[model samples]
Target: LLADDGGHPAVRTGADRLTLTPVAELGLGLGEGGAALTVLPLIQSALLLASAAGPATVYTVDSQDVLADPDTIRA
Candidate 1:
């Protein structure tokens, strides 16, 4: 997942997957830690946000569904 961090399109593709897990999983944190990611309310959230402790948000996107769809991200 790439974010321009500016006012630009944020297109996503199923050609690949980007995942962020707990920081503790890296064996750096003594106890436990996470990336502390915050995401908007969108289908992409399904990839960036999920937990057995939260509301179920299941969504699947076809490879072409998001591929370079600037309009989808621009909105």
Candidate 2:
């Protein structure tokens, strides 16, 4: 699961106390362009997770309507 502590600097200290996997590049290396391309994969991953989780699961329950909607999520 991805968690952002709103970029708070203080959280960095506590972060060392917990195990956290760094997000993979997923072939998407750093860039100052292709904003849409970068976001599309992220959206796809979230949708895939939600779909596998099935309807009414925590994934569906927690996401906004559009996010959880199968019709709205592209593979």
Candidate 3:
């Protein structure tokens, strides 16, 4: 989103620590400067537990809506 929205991203763990990953530069910038872009994805659960200090304390849940009803999904 940094490429399209001009905002930063971050993550938080159960231990309450927050970490920021530096976004990779997209070759050149928005015509206002140099420019480029890229896509995004995921992270592993084990590493997330480690960041929380241990698995015993970490609880994770993921949810995705059915696309059959795009309007509901958007809502």
Per-candidate Cα RMSD to the true structure, in Å, reads 16.1, 13.9, 16.8
Instruction: Give the per-residue Cα lDDT of candidate 3 at 21.
Output: 30
Regions of model 2 farther than 4 Å from truth: 1-33, 57-75
Writing each residue's lDDT as its tens digit, candidate 1 over 1-75 gives 322222112312321234422222222222221212222234245645664357755656555657857244321
Tens digits of per-residue lDDT for model 2 on 1-75? 223322444543565457542233333333333334555687789899999988872332324756667455323
Q: What tens digits encode model 3's per-residue C-alpha lDDT throughout 1-75?
A: 133222312212321242333244443324442222232322244456678885354433334434354334321
Q: What lDDT, from 0 to 1, does candidate 1 have?
A: 0.33
Error of 3 at 37 (Å): 5.0
Which of candidates 1 and 2 reaches a greater lDDT?
2
Q: Residue 45 of candidate 1: its Cα lDDT? A: 57
Worst 10 residues of 3 by lDDT: 6-15
Which residue pairs does candidate 1 place in steric collision? none
Could you give me the TM-score of model 2 versus the true structure? Answer: 0.32
Clashes of 1: 0
Error of 2 at 63 (Å): 26
